[model samples]
Target chain A: MTQQPAKKLYIHDVCVRDGFQMESVFVPTDAKVDLINRLSLTGLAKIEVTSFSSPKAIPALADAESVLVNLNRVPTVEYTALIPNARGCERALKCELDEHNVVMSASETHNRANLRMTRDQSLAQFAEIVRLTNGTVAVNASLSTAFGCPFDGQICDDDLLANIDRIAEIGIKRLTLCDTTGMANPAQVRRICELVLTRFPELTVTAHFHNTRGMGLANCIAALEGGITRFDASLAGLGGCPFAPGASGNACTEDMVHMFNAMGYDTGIDVANLIPLANEIPSLVGHDVPGQVMKAGSYDRIYPMPDWLGGKEQTRLAGSGNALIDPECRVTEVAK
Target chain B: MTQQPAKKLYIHDVCVRDGFQMESVFVPTDAKVDLINRLSLTGLAKIEVTSFSSPKAIPALADAESVLVNLNRVPTVEYTALIPNARGCERALKCELDEHNVVMSASETHNRANLRMTRDQSLAQFAEIVRLTNGTVAVNASLSTAFGCPFDGQICDDDLLANIDRIAEIGIKRLTLCDTTGMANPAQVRRICELVLTRFPELTVTAHFHNTRGMGLANCIAALEGGITRFDASLAGLGGCPFAPGASGNACTEDMVHMFNAMGYDTGIDVANLIPLANEIPSLVGHDVPGQVMKAGSYDRIYPMPDWLGGKEQTRLAGSGNALIDPECRVTEVAK
Candidate 1:
């Protein structure tokens, strides 16, 4: 067997922010703080609490300030906000944010549609935001649609590299290469992550994948193979790309944690603590979420035999000389 | 960038047999033939049409003989059946069957519960069935719960290897290692596949993964890295462990074909042709299947502009501006 490269992994929970952003009900600001606080205690490396976008643009996150100021921060957990512009950065700076996550779409059409700005204009704004946040809050320049776009097709490596170089040069150390519309495959993720690493060897590459095509975890596996250690995931798989109505949620954090943890890689996040919250997301979000781990239960969680199978179950268990049924088998026959 | 090994992939669609067995609703015998005939035309390498078992045991697939005899057999596709014993072998021998797929769970508990026999008993039965089929039909000895079992925690590699060795010695050329419970991770998959290859170098290894825990595709990816080229998939992700209620179906054939074909590996199955069938499965099975490519459309299928974004969407083409909006974006803009 090939030796698996075990490394320290970082999981950043984006449920309260990125997840709730897609919710139209506008999750109460107190609930957002409660979730973030609970997530912080889960030993996660980071928690993206809320987006510092124009409240007028996204009324769902109009209470970003309220959510952030009330956060019960753990010293080890980094708190971040998806900052859209200088105004968002100014607001984030007031809240003692650890990271200001500025984003621009790699596709021009997506940038204008999503952010109401040109690619060049978005980059310029990010650079200025980086300058403003430097020495105070860390900057995460996220390039949405880094793999492919909804309005445009594939984003060429050259354009992505150029963007990465500009962001890195501006002293922003973190970069989130996002499959904004879940357009990335394993090979594509591996190739793009490799290209990005080769260009900016010092850049921290965080994978932000969507499960739109049911490849969120698969893509994460490929990125891990490509040597990426950080990933942006949503608890309970709560978030979908606001743009793609039919697309699924971000890679479910509990699912990813389960895979990495079961494979003996250390993410340092407690999966046991994340389960209740993950299961609660469907109710909170007013719909079914795309998480599989919760539905399937943890890998080691043995299921009891269904009541319908009791008669057949008895014949098998009592019959097999080598049988050792699960202690909690649901279909155990009563003594005759 | 590290090079991806582009190998020829064998996709065996198990929708008619394994998929239908889980459904309480008995899909009519004609519908079974129709689905199998449609699947045969999809350029799939293999189509496991039905299981040759006691009709009383599984009422759903009692018409295995009629289905096999009536197949509009594709010259390129191999048709197989799940043969449990000499009786099954006798039934399959009557038809022009390509192969007899005999299965035994690696987990003793699961083997006993599912097959009403000990592991050794099942193995002995497979050997006898092999003797019965002789040179006429190929035998694919499938070891279910080879990765992890619902009743048992983990199947030890040594016991598994021994079971595999004995089966191989019995002249079964094709072996399928099944994650019957969908409890496998990528690393675990890679580890086991590597072990299997290292031991029995000449055996044709096939991965039988379920999307139970949502890691089906991820496990497939890892198996590919471990030098496996054959996979057992079901159309529209139809098939679940009858024993495990909440677990999802097998990895969808179209999804796997899409992933492999997109990565430049040759599965030779056309994804476009599989889509309509994938969509048809939910209604056929009387419930929702976990297939995603069907729901979200293909990975590259671009969505059109929503009404409010039209002026900007028009400007996107009508003007040089990059502008778009998420169809569900809550910030549609309040009237001034």
Candidate 2:
């Protein structure tokens, strides 16, 4: 797998938007601004700052405008927000966002249940949102249930491709194929991603995966092997499918970035710097998140020898010629 | 990726031995026997019943002999046990086991820290254990930290191949490459596994992975793509690296099986039957486990619409022409 060099990968964090949207408790605007500012310095290529939805529908993100205005902008990082309709597009345009992400579902049942609109209604509304922007800001259409649906089961290849064509016709250049409710398999992900990338070579395709059934990272790998360069991930795996009962969170950000870097791809994001930020999420959300790297540490983290081994054995191990063994093993002592 | 069909896959469950060893609470011998008997019916190709290590070293499996003697074995399931030394091999031989798995570490620091023996000592002792078996039962060697070590950062490729060569020379036909602390990335796994499979075509290699760094299932995919067919998984994601602080459990059996089945591979194990058993593990171990499938149902599971949607909208949905929407969706009603 390492014999061939891979294309440079871009990691886009959706924690502040997708992740926080699922939280029942309201997060203070100052904390949201602080988190986004800290994330901006972590080398991420893009960050989804907030969602411009009706405050009554999503009370958790009612302070989206406040968060976008307060955060210190990083010139190198692209900032985007989720726009649900033409009203949302107007709000996002006022903020001078780098990108406006419009959302809809590939399946009719999901489109109705999630957005309370028919598939055609969603397409027309999305088209209006695109025209409202008028090329002032880039538009990225996120097609939910692209793999499979909780309301509607397996999505056919023809319908999925047709939906993409309609979204492209609305003048959108970027698309995110979302596995809403985490119903995707690796084989299916690889097949569909390859098909989309082949059919639309000019479009930028991003994969959005959920870890509800624990196939999130596996699907990410398949998408990567199928030539996907952009990904949507959540810090600390904080987002969940409110429609799917007992579902977990989205694909984790630090964990995904760590894998990409380990697999010899330059993601332009440092996982080590994302760890401390991820560790503080449980306190911010008032719950334990599903991130494993935050708890397990990085793969290269060297743990100290047990106390029973004593300093004599430790000293002997320190002098070993094997380069794999770190002589300074005692730098970070963890209780066994 | 699925253009060519894959070889038959074999799943081996090690929950009774490896999963319980790390638990602070000791599960009763009857429960262990019952769980193994139930697992036998799940169509698993092999089951690691228990370890014959010193009782002092693993109080959790102190009743190894009694549990192995009492469980009702299925004719199709091959039973195996972990043998730590010559004494353990003798005990396993007395039980008339189908296979005896002798373990050691590929890295010197991990070998000493985990087993209190040098690499030469472990190799010599493993050779003696193979000799003691005398062809009465199959011998499989598990090389820990084959991918990388928690104490030692990375195991060199040359050393890893050399260790495998030594194990093969000891007359062991089956070997498991263990990611002891989950230090492996997908690229490394695919590259090394391809090399091993090509060099040792006669050997049956099983991939044993830990979910410590959240790459367990992803690593499994890489290994599968590299031609590995056998896997060692733990129920409810039990078992962890004692040396790696805050490490999670092994790659979850139900989760991996779910992914494999979804990807169109026949592992001969029905994931639905394994889930109810996995759901009962937290009570058995007295804590929450890391398995995701047990909490989130299988991908095909169809949940009922929310009560607020009412019967009228649901009735319309029930009549939809799409095959994805199950008309019997109300059979399993879940509160959203």
Candidate 3:
């Protein structure tokens, strides 16, 4: 009898590229290397290592080459970099990359604002970057603002499909439909995914969602229902578009892994291993991260009962409703 | 010609109860009143005003009676409160409440921990609360931890149905199935809603979700498709159960409203009016709120170029290979 195919979910960790870019403090090159190295052990399918952008645009990833060079590469994991143009692609190629990622915004206005290029100009740049790199490195085109654009209003589903078709025609290895501003709802996500998958049967479509509008995971589920098997998430919900105003954070990788694992879906990621790396992020960046799992602990992380738990006083308090005192009141009432 | 019935969605704001209860600082009674007054103008169907737990248990709502007395009640809006027991019910009976909300956990352990009663005992108390009130106020039975309990693993769907049946037998006006720990997935949501609706078609059901595991909104959509129209949301994503480990925040009200409005579903809520109130929440409580729309702004609120100008930037971003950067790059670089 043929062995049943193992059911597994693929997660692409975007912390190094997307997560750090949103932070107020710049993470060091060594820290980025250490972060990616730690994350690699967590069993993520891919790690978006860095962005090959001009140093002037994003000061955070100025040492992208050094960070990539120092990483402990896991044989099973794919490491990728974001290339905004042919120049960025050339820089990525110089790093001896196995794969290069390019992005084009679905909205014309956003494309211009993001890359300072019109739609044709960005596509032309992508095709040229693909040619310049040759077949040595894989090319994955990310369609930004696929669900909705921050600068432009609702993106028509046809508009998104058209972008995918153009990218597919270029023979790119993969496509990630990004909800750059978290404007997608489940129905819209389902409709878009269904349309795209129907048109591009051979394309490997992935989802990248931001939690800007509180629908990140919801959109992810919709995409999964729409037949998507891969997703991009950031640790501790770190990362936002460096160029996109008002965008907050990406969907938390640990949180996503926790949800998928709880639902009996295999994500390959170990939530326990991911937690330490997630917690280290706040100290590295000089601010608390957006992810809750790192600070609050996972569903299975148990706290030992207090020393007074079995005592007579504890028994009295436990049985009474007074033990249910509002948690917030403790702070103010004590302060007073 | 017969016009199709306008699709309507109901908004049940949980700000006063869920939102305030989760915060670290205690909101003054007047501030709570002012917030509810502003929210009343936004066309919410119901507002969960306060909880009638003992002052010793939930000191944050020590002024619950005063807040209830001062509410600027709208003609169409129903004001509700959470009643924990017979004493809590007696306290709530003093207020001119349109509805009294009672809760029982599906998990026996959780019911014991949260209410100091077993699941059966909690249900028994709910029956008494129902009998004592005698239809004087609408009683909404909220089945907490209905999706899955943090203490216990997955809650059986049959157990949820059994609880609903027990509550319905007591003549409760409505029921809300709560994913207290955000353990619900879309498929599970669909299955539960279908099973419940099929078994009890006359019962009005609402969905209460948390964004803990990122599937909150996804689960909501699944319920919507499963024929659920009512939902509970907290403004600015406020509220978490302190006693319930791993619980984060509720679904953001403005985000849900935005999705409903964009999908052409009528929620009768003014999305624009909600933004200012959502924005003010972080300052009132001395911490940043979790909701994203108030910070990110809506799709239409972004930069807009006048349409009458026949702007060159309005051109489509995708079409043919003419949009390609270079054929050589497309053939060579993107081939892998």
How many clashing pairs per prediction, in order?
6, 0, 6
Q: What are the per-residue Cα lDDT tens digits for candidate 2 across B109-188?
A: 78888888888898898899888988889999999999887766777777888999998998899999999888888888
Q: Residue B193 in model 2: shift from native, Å?
A: 0.8
Pairs clashing within candidate 1: A112-B322, A112-B323, A113-B323, A113-B324, A243-B326, A305-A330
Candidate 1, RMSD to the unseen true structure: 7.9
lDDT of 3 by residue, B144-232 (tens): 98876655545665667788888898888589999887667666777778888899887889999886656667677778888898999
TM-score of 2: 0.93
TM-score of 3: 0.86
Off by over 4 Å in 2: A1-6, A243-247, A307-336, B1-6, B307-336
lDDT: worst 10-residue window of model 2 chain B: B327-336
Ranking by lDDT: 2, 1, 3
For model 1, how big is the iRMS in angstroms?
Answer: 11.6
Docking class of 2: acceptable
Give every prediction's interface RMSD: 11.6, 8.3, 12.9
| lDDT for predicted candidate 3 compared with the true structure | 0.77
In candidate 2, residue B288 scores what lDDT? 86
Please give the lDDT score at residue A86 for candidate 2.
Answer: 85
